[model samples]
Target chain A: MQKVVKSFGANTVLNALDLDIAKGEIVSLIGPSGSGKSTLLRCINLLEPIDDGEIWFGGIDISVPGYDPNPVRRRIGMVFQSYNLFPHMSVMENICLAPVRVLGRKANDTKAQALALLEQFGLADKAKSYPDQLSGGQQQRVAIVRALTIEPEVLLLDEITSALDPELVGEVLDAVRNLRNTGMTVVLATHEMSFAREISDTVCMLDGGVIIEKGSPESIFTNATNPRTRQFLSRVNSR
Target chain B: MIATVSTLAVAITLIVAIPKMPRWDRVKKSFFNGEVLGETFPKLLDAFVLDIKIFLWSVPIILFIAMLVAVTRNSRSPALFPLRILAVVYVDVMRGVPVLLWIYLIGFGVPGLGLERPWNSPLLWGTVALVLTYATYVSEVFRAGIESVHESQRAAARSLGLSNAQTMRHVVLPQAVRRVIPPLMNDMVSLQKDVALVSLIGPIEILRQAGIDKSKFASFTPYVGAAIIFLAITIPMTRTTDWLLERERRRTSGTRVS
Candidate 1:
C-alpha cells in the first residue's frame, strides 16, 4: 500500500500512509486509542474503499475504480476485535462456511480440513459447540481458523484478543504465535505492547494517522528516535 | 385466598347475569341453536378446505416477497438507490392500505378487466391482494430482524471475502430469521383468519359458506359454528406462538434479539 488515504468527511483518519509488508514477516501496528491502526488494516483488506492510493497485491492494483474487492479479499483474511462468529452456526460450521461458499470446496472435504485445523488450535472438543458455549479464547481461535481456511496470502489481526479476559488472552496469542512458524505473512493492530515486542519483526508506531517511526521492536521500544514515539511509549509503559 | 375469591366472583357474575338478560331466550335461539350448529358443522368444515388451500399457497409467496423486499430495503450500495426507493414505496403503500380493501379492489376489480379464464378468476386476484398486503408487514418484521444483527457481523463476513449476497445467505438471514420466528408466526395467525376474506370476492370459503347457511336457516348459529372452526386452528397457533415466546423469554431472561 502506497500513499493510502482514508477519511470520514472532515476527519482524516489515514493521511497518505505507505506500508510495505514482506512475504513471510510479522508486522505489528501500535498506536493510541484514536489512531488509524484499525483503519489501515481495513484498507489493506479492501473492506473500506480507500479515498486515494494504490494497493498492489500479487502484481495487481486492487484499488482501481469499480474494482471488485471480493477476489482481493479472498487472498487476505482478517479477524476482528470481537470474534464475529455466526452464533446461529456451530464452531465447525463457522469454520466451514467460507471454505464452502467462497472457495467452492466440497462440503465433506472442507469439514475434514476444518476438523484438523480445530485439532491444531486445541479446540477439537469444541467442534460441535456454539460460540456462546465456548470461552472467549476458544471463540477467537475459531475465528482465526475461519480466516485461515480461505488460504489467504496475508492475515490481518485487528486486536484479536482485546475482548478476552486476562487469563484467556494467552491462549489466543499462542495460536497466533503458532501461525508464525508456517511462514504466513501476518499484520496486526494491537494494544498489547509486550506481546508486540515479543513477536513483531517490525513495529510501526502510528500517531495522527501516519507512521511516525517504524523499526525493530528493540529500536522502537527502547532506543526510540521520535519525540511522539517516546511520549506514546511512556504512556503505554506507565499503564 | 383473594385470587380464588375474585376468580369465582367474576365467573359467577357472568354466568348469572348473562342468562338473566331480557332477551336471553331469543339470543339462545339465534346464536346457540344446537340444531343449526350440528347441521352446518360439516359443510362449514368442507368449505374451510378452500381457506386452507389459499393459505398454503399464499404463505410461501408472502415469505418470498417479504424476504426480497427486506433485503432490497436494507441495501447500502448507491447503485441500488432506485431499487431501494421502489422497495420503500411498495412497503409503505402495501402496509398503508387495509388488507380487506386490497382484497375487495383487486379481487372484484381485476376480474372486471375481462381477462382470460385463469387470469379472470377472483380466487387468483384475491390471493394476490392478500400476498401484497401481508408481505409488506412481514417484510417489516424481516427488516427488524436483519437490523437487529450487529454491524460487526457484516464486517466479519465481508472480511472473509463473501459478497453481499453470500453474506446475507450464509451469515445474516439465518440469524435474522431465527430472531423473528415468533413475530412471523403471529403474522401467520392473522393471515390464516384473513384467508377467509377472499370469500368476499367470490369463491365460497368457510365464512361465505356460513353466510349461506345463515340465510338458508334464517338463523345466526352457522356463524358461531364457523367461528368454532377458525378457532380450532387459530387457538392452537396462538398458543404455540405464546409458548415459543415464553420459552424464548425464559431462555434469555428477556428474549434478547441479539
Candidate 2:
C-alpha cells in the first residue's frame, strides 16, 4: 500500500501511509488502539477500501478503481480478530468452503487437502466438529488453515490473538510462527510487542494514522529513532 | 333433543363398531356397495386434489413476493421507511381479518370491476387471496431469518470477494434460513390448514365436500371421517417438524460445548 488515505467522515484513520512488504517477509504492524494498524491491514485485502493509494499485490494494481478484485483476493487471505469461521460448517468444511466455491475444486479433492492442513495444525481430530465446539485458539488455527487452504500467496492477520485468553494466545502465535517459518508472506497487526519483536523481521510503529518509524525489529525495538515510537512501544510493552 | 340424541348415538356406534368389527368380505362389500360412502370418497378425493392444486400454485408466488418485501424492508435506501410501514400494515391487516373475508372480497368484489377471463376465474381469485394473505406472514418470517444472521458474517463474506447478492445467497442466507426452519415449517403447516378456508367461495375443497356430504347423507359420519383424515395427514407432518427442530437445536447446542 502506497500513499493510502482513508477517513470515516471527518476523522481520518489512515493518512498517506506508504508500506511495501516483500514476498516471504513477516512484517508486524504495532500501534495503540485506533491508530490505523488494523485499518491498514484491512486495506491490503481491500476489506476497507483506500480513499487514495495504490495496493499492488502479485502484479495486480488494486489501487485502480473498479478493478475486478476476486482474482487478486484469491492470492490474499485474511484472518480477523474474531476468527470468522462459518459456524454452520464443520472445521473441515470451513477450510474447504472457499476452495470448492471460489476455486471450483472437487469435494473429494478439497476434503483431502483440508484434512492435510488440519492434521498439520494438529487439529485432524477436530475435522468433523463445528467451530463453536473448538476453543478460541483452536478456532483461530482452523481459521488460519481455512485461509491457507485456498493457497493464498499473502496472509493477513488482524489482531488474531486479541480475542484469545492469555493462556491460549501462545498456541495461536505458535501456529502463526510456524506459517512464517514455512515461507508464507505474513502481515500482522498486533498489540503483543514482545511477540512482534520475536517473530517479525520488520516492525513498523504507527501513530495518528501515520507510520512514525519503520525498521528491522532490532532497530525499532532497541534503537527507535522517533520519540513517539518509543512512547508507544513503552505503553504497549508495559501493558 | 331427538336430533342431539341421534347424533350422539351415531357417533358412539361408529366409534365402537368401526374398529371392533371383524374383517370380513361381507362388511367390505357392504361399504363398497353403499351409495353414500361411494359418493363421499370421490367428492373427498376431488376436494383434496383441488386443495393441493391451489396450494402448489399459491406457495411459489407468495414466496417470491414475500422475499421481495423482506429485502426491501431491510434495504438502506431512503424509501425503506415507507416500505417498512407498508409491509407492517399489510401483515397486520391480512393477519387481523379472517381469510374467508379476503376470499369473499377478492372473489366476489373483484369480478364486479369487469376484469378479463383469467382474473374472473374462481381458482385465480381464491389463489390470489391465499397468496396475498400468506405472503405478508411469510415476509415477516423471512425478515426475521435475514436479521438473525450476524453483521460480521456479511463483512466476512464481502472480504472474501463475494458481492452482496452472492453473500446473501451463499453465506448469510444459508445460515439464516437454517436458523428459521422451525418457524418456516410452522408457517407451511398453517398454510395447509388455511387452504380449508377457500371452500367458503364455493370451491369444492375438502371441508366443502365434507359439508356437502353431511347435508346429503342426513348423517355426520362423513364429516367426522374427513376430520379423521385431516388429523392423519397433519399429525405426522407436525411430528416430523418437531423432530427436525429438535435435531437442529441439539446440533447447535452440542457445538457450543467446547
Candidate 3:
C-alpha cells in the first residue's frame, strides 16, 4: 500500500499510510486504541476504501475505483477480535461456507478439506458443534481455520486475542505462532507486546494513523530512538 | 380439598345463575339456536376455504415483498438511495393506510381504472391489497431481525471473500430469519384474521357467508358460527407458532436435553 488515506467525516483514521509486506513475513502493528492500526489492516483487505493512494498487490491495483474486491479478498484472509463465527452454522459448515460457495469448490471436497483443517487445529471433535457450544478459545481457532481454508496469500488479524480470557489468549497466540512457522504472510494488530517481540519480523508502532517507528522487534522494543515510541513503550511496559 | 370445593362451587353457581341472566332466552335464540347453528356451521366452514386460499397464496408473496423491501431499506450504497426512499415511502404509505381501506380502494378502484381483465378481478385486487399492507409491517420485522445481527458477522463474511449478496444469503439472512420467526409467525396469524377484511370486496369468505345467512334467517347464530371457524383455524396456528418459538429458544439456549 502506498500513501493510503482513509477518513471518517472529519476524523482521518489513516493518513497517507504506506506499508509493504514481503512474502512469508510476519509484521505486527502495535498502538494505542484508535491509533488506526485496524484501519490500516482493513484498507489492505479492501474492507475500507482508501481516499488517495494505490494498493499494489499481486501486480494489480486493488484500490482502483469500483474495483471488485471479492476476487482480491479471496487472496487475503482476516480474523477479527471477536470470533464472528456464523452462529447458525456448525463449525464444519462455517469452515466450508466460503470454500464451497465463493470458491465454487465441490461440496464433498471442501468438507473433506475443512475436516482436515479442523483435525490439524485440534478441533476435529468440534466439527459438528455450533460456535456458542464451544469455548471462546476454540471458537477463535475455528475462525482461524475458516480463514485458512481459503488459502489466502496475506492474512490480516485485527486484535485476534484481545477478547479472549488471559488463559485462552495463549492458545490463540500459539496458533499464530504455528502459522508463522509455516511461513504465512501475516499482519496482526495486537496489545501483546512480548508476543509481537517474539514473532514479528518487523514491528511498526503506529501513532495517529502513521507509522512513527518501524524496525526489528529488538531495536523497537529496547533501543528505540524516537521520543514518542519511547513514551508509548514506557507506558505499556509500566502496565 | 379446598381448591376442589371452590372450583365446584363456582361451576354450580354459574349453572344456577345461567337461566336468571338478563335476556338469556333472546341471547340463546340469537347466538345458539340449534337449527340455525346446524345450518350455519357447514356453510361457514365451506366458505372459510376461500379465506384459507387467500392466506396461503398471499403469504409467500408477502414474505418475498417484505424481504425485498427490508434489504432495500437497509442498503447503504449511494446508488440505492432512490430505491431506499421508494421502499421507505411504500412501507409508510401502506402501513399508515387502514387495511380495510386498501381492500376497498384496490378492489373497487382498480376495476374502475379500466385496466386489464386480471387487474379488474376483485379477488385478485383484494389479495394484492392484503399483501401490500401486511408486507409493510413484515418488512419492519425483517429489518429489525437483519439489524439485530452483529456487524462483526458481516465483516467476517466479507473477509472470507463473499460478495454482499453471498454474505447476506449464507450468513446474515439465515440468522436474521431465525431470530425473527416468532414475530413473523405472529404477523401471519394476524394476516389470517385480516383475510376476513377481503370479504367486503365480494369474495364470499366465512364472514360474508355468515352475513348472508344472518339476513336470511334473521338470527346472529351464523356470525357466532363464523367466529368458531376462525378460532378453529387461528388457535392451532397460534399454538404452532408458540411451540416452534419455544423449541427454537430451547435449542439456542442449549437447554434441550436430547
TM-score of each: 0.92, 0.78, 0.92
- Report residue A137 deviation for candidate 1 (angstroms): 1.5
Tell me the tens digit of each residue's lDDT in model 3 across B1-258.
999999999999998999799999999888898899998889899999999999999999999999999999988789999999999999999999899999999888888889887668898998899999999999999999999999889989999999998888888899999989888988998999999999998889999999999999999999999888888888998798789878766554443577
Candidate 2 lDDT by residue in tens digits, A1-239: 78899999999999999888999999999988999998898788777767887888877788687787677778888888998888887888777778777888899999998888888878999998887778888888888888888787788889988877887677777777888777899999998887798889899999999888999999999899899998887886777
Across the candidates, what are chain A's individual TM-scores? 0.96, 0.95, 0.96
Q: Where does candidate 3 stray beyond 4 Å? A: B1-25, B113-119, B253-258
lDDT of 3 at A180: 80
The 10-residue segment with the lowest total lDDT in model 2 chain A: A167-176
Which regions in candidate 2 have their CA more than 4 angstroms from the true location?
A165-168, B1-49, B68-120, B207-239, B255-258
lDDT, candidate 1, at A72: 85
lDDT tens string, model 3, A162-197? 877888677777778888877799999999898789
The docking quality of candidate 2, as DockQ, is: 0.27
Clashes of 3: 0
In order, what lDDT does every prediction score? Answer: 0.91, 0.81, 0.91
Q: How would you encode candidate 2's per-residue C-alpha lDDT over B115-218 as one tens digit per residue?
A: 89977776678778889988888888888999998887776666665666666777777787787777777787788878888888777889888888878776
Best first by DockQ, ranked: 3, 1, 2
Residue-wise lDDT of candidate 1 within A1-239, one digit each (tens)?
89989999999999999888898899999999879999999888888899998988888899897889998889999999888998878888899888889999999999999999999888899888878777777888899999999989899999987887887677766877878888889999999998899889999999888898999999999999999999999998998
lDDT of model number 1: 0.91
